[model samples]
Target: MKPRILLVDDEENILKQLRWALEPDYEILIAQDEYEAKRIFEIMGPAVVTIDLSLTPGNSQDLSGLRLLEYFLTQAPSTRIIVITGSSDEASSLQAVRLGAFDYYSKPIRLDELKVMIKRAFHIHQLHQRIQQSYPGSAEGFHGMIGKSKSMQEIFRFIERIAASDVSVLIAGENGTGKKLVAHAIHNLSQRKDNPFAAVNCGASPEHSLESELFGHERGAFFGAYAQKRGKLELAHTGTLFLDEISKLTPALQVKMLRFLKNRKIERVGGTQTIDLDVRIIAATNHDLLENNVFDKDLYYRLKLVPLPPLRERKEDIIPLAHYFVKKLCRGRRSPPIMLSPEAEGALLMHPWAGNIRELENLISRAVVLSSHSVLKPSDLGFALNSIPTDVNLKFAKKAIEADFIKKALSKNNGIVSRAAKDLGISRVNLYELMDRYNIQIQEFKISRSSERQQMKTGEVL
Candidate 1:
């Protein structure tokens, strides 16, 4: 059976035209006014709806259509609503979108364009359903990490499985990808849950200070050591110690850390007495420590790795995560309920999310603080139609490298797709995909080859 769609418009001709065009694809339900539309919507629960903004026939000011749109959304936030308005009524159309309509189409709606918009709405609705169905628990997310993708599900399961063990664990991911959160979750679920969880940023302080922070210094040990101090490892005692940015640890500190990991003992700076501690180690890094050769191999091998996926790779989680952030931020501010406009959601989906979950939370927080409207549009989240990359150097470098490799391979192969694919060790299909992704014109490469050949021939003739 075809998917159901509700069409609410006062004009009989418009309804008939849409039914004729869409009947083949969707189970068409037509409503001539708000009352009929609401009745059908309540009964049928269609996945998509197209409603005219002015539903009171001659009264152009009547906003029953907007009210109906709001009602449908309130009933089912996942419902895709496409608002239709007169070509001159742009203000009403914008207002309808701001009220959480999926999209807006103006008068003189060509059947083809309207059909395309309806198709996109259904697609987005299906995605929302898939995310909700796949996500197991409430919107609070898995141990504070919000993700609906299969990768995240696996990560959650992995955390649960390893939380009972006492082995050293390493959580690895790009910066702002919530490595520290995972570390905390591991500790919270472990047997040492009642004990204090101590956290230290290896990269946040100078080398001497970081060493002193991790392994306490006795009085008179250093210039600022006015009193005997307990370090993170010592303070944690029977609990977990989260070492963030562990790759930044200096070689001297790494040696001391490895020794402690092996023997579960530590010596304070300028102190002879050795301290026996039973702290579980949970280290996190944004870089590949082993691959970079900056971290100690013995220490790296001791910890079990838990690699977290970046936000861009988990598109299914974007909307849910955004909503979660909005709710959290609004509740903190004692603000009323705020909804993300479909336009804003689309913008978020399109973004590359260089800064991952942290970036997303910050954007939503900014929007909630600054925007007075109950609904957030793309502009409210600092995202334009053409969104820019967040200020993350690593993501930019990776993109640049990938594009350069493709261009070099194409140049070496004289614009031949097969040869370039072989050079890049990828399929021709993949090469073409990459070329399209980077907006690299094959015609430019092919034309350059032709021009070079022509130049050679002209020189020979001369």
Candidate 2:
């Protein structure tokens, strides 16, 4: 089907011109007033929208367009929006972009240039869709998980293979490695993409509230249950329910979960009727299911297809994942995507990534805020690079050279301390303590070559 574009303008001449320019290329939705625009918005839900800056009482002002922009963006965050403004409306145009408009066209609009702007808007929308659909699971996949490690790719493959199935999935990862995205991907790929993919963080919600949120409540289900309300499970019927920190489930809740897993049914709080569902279930945890032995064996078996390896082991995928997040999180914002300079990328590579992908994402976001140049610098990322070849001071030259020497020795040893120490003409014990002192991750000291080429072919990244 042809993508739809809702064209909102009070002037008949401008609407006619746009319709003439774009109707052949798109399905045009024309709205002459705010009321008409809203009506079209509710019904058509166009893929993109174009609104003029002047559509009020005098039909020649900026405020009307700004208000409409806010309403449209609020209504549909993913929809591409383009604003039209007069030559004098430079501040309004930038305001539009800040308000989340994709781009603004200065009027009297040039037809061919306007076409390019419209095309770019569509391009942004398509890229967003791709990111949402095929995000590889892991912290790296979220805001960029750390390490381009082989183990991470294996996890990616595992997620891809299982995303097509309706079987319950269990994701096991370290605390900060982003197990939730894996759960999300599975939900998105399953047969219920259109339905709500409701998620509840088991560890975050209190026991009482968790129960109420999961199964909902009747008017008198609990002390605060003033009115009957639908639970996450009910809202997620025919879709997917993602439970995070699954290991945190209390013993009583575990029994409830196991029953639902086996029976495909739930009873609302204080309600007697059993509700059968086709909702798919995905569970995630920071704890090792096999190690804790607290997870119900039956439920664990039902959920487990196996766990994804941690980010520290996935060295090969780190850079690509970082690039993916840099594009997603920074681009087209008040501060657009800042390029990672060679030093910045190297600094990122050198870190142990203790918090894994989540940590990296936070760093990148912070860097975007701090960076002065178009290219993000190491200092912008808040890391004191031992390998800093270019600090403002020449006084640190000796320290930099020593850091380089230590790094070279570690590399020659293939992460074997004894061998690296021998190569450096130092004691293995000394080297071990030195590496720790410098915060070097011996296991990930080197970058992975021959990157994983396969893009996630499974569920979308939403």
Candidate 3:
């Protein structure tokens, strides 16, 4: 199929030149003014559009072209936009990027280089379009989640249900299950979708900061209280506030949170007024909240627990979830849907995902980038299970759990970091961070590859 192109310029010569150069690759449509350009856009819905910064009515000042770019971004975000600017207008060209223009080329067009950029942009456009078509939802609806398994379908149902109400939702899943993504989905689908969706890790922050962050502090409340600052609850008013790892909150904070849950009111650290909050609270826990005494039963009960079945128990959803994350992340790469060989699929089923869905996301992503072949084999998934010692505790340290999780995904991806990152829905940078955090060695991992591939192969995957 021939790709469609829309060319806009005030200068007659430039339009003719671009048409002559890019015509071999696309059916080019030329427009000399902003009004004509938009008309052509509405009719043609071109795959790629190159618009000059200066148009017929606003030749010297390029505000009209800027507005056109903004309109294009808002109306047809999948369309790749390349802005044409004068040689002297570097500042204005950069401003186009700020307005969400895909790429900018200075005037006095270099046809050869500009064509390459346009082609690359179109590829990315096509990829993102494919994602939208396949998912049938905005990025904010699904974001990084990739699942079609019955279990995942159930999770989607839960998200839809909770998003309709203001009741507190408690998401329960094993480590690395994308609970945070679920919380985000709930917020995005709710009545407060347009409002602030604030999040803070209950386990990560210091106790004092957690208190101040959840409940605002007045000036002179503590040593660091130089000025009055509203906490997360106050800021999240009329929005959704996500408290991740709720089971990890200190007992003291749990008591305070319980009060907030009941009263829907907060007292600043040094202030007397009890501020009311209209925020929806969503809490997540990797721990077995019902069994763990470390987690407050009163607060957990109040939060209204939503239990998430671990990946092991929901084996039917593995392939669907794998396809989802891979398709979503590979949107710009134009990468094909990754195929898992029957052996690979068996490996996915056999392994109990201790880290759950998060581990799966990292594995598939890594495999997509690192696999030379389109189909992923068992070896490609690094699924030779590592032996775990009985003494190694997964309960307390989040990093310890994360390390075990990555190791499993790496094993599934066959020690491929890029694939592992995708499988886990994390960036390659994050994979490296996990390696360091867990002190894992890739060499001991069964799937062998490049030098850095040897990095954390030895990490325990339990």
Best by TM-score: 2
TM-score per candidate: 0.55, 0.59, 0.56
Put down candidate 2 lDDT per residue, 298-351, tens digits, no spaces: 787777554665554454455566676677666536455568776676666556
Which candidate has the highest lDDT of all? 1
Ranking by lDDT: 1, 3, 2
21 Cα displacement, candidate 3 (Å): 39
Worst 10 residues of 1 by lDDT: 453-462
Clashes of each: 0, 17, 38
Q: Residue 179's C-alpha lDDT in candidate 3?
A: 82
For residues 1-462, write the lDDT of model 1, one tens digit per residue.
Answer: 578899998888888899999999998888987887876675456899999888876788797988999899876667899998888998888888877889999988899999999999999988976776465476757766787766688788888878887788888899798897798778867888646577888989999988888999999998989999878888788888888889888999999999999999999987999999999999998897878587788888788888887887666678889899899777657689999986677677767889999999889998999999999887888876455444323354456557767776786567899999998899999988999999998866665656788545322310
What shift in Å separates residue 183 of candidate 3 from its native position after superposition? 1.1
How would the candidate models be sorted by TM-score, starting from the highest? 2, 3, 1
Candidate 3 Cα errors over 4 Å, as ranges: 1-144, 292-294, 335-338, 384-462
lDDT of 3 by residue, 94-138 (tens): 999877788899866678899899999889988976776476445
Of candidates 3 and 2, the better by lDDT:
3
| Cα lDDT computed for each candidate against the true fold | 0.82, 0.72, 0.75
Query: How many collisions between residues are there in candidate 3?
Result: 38
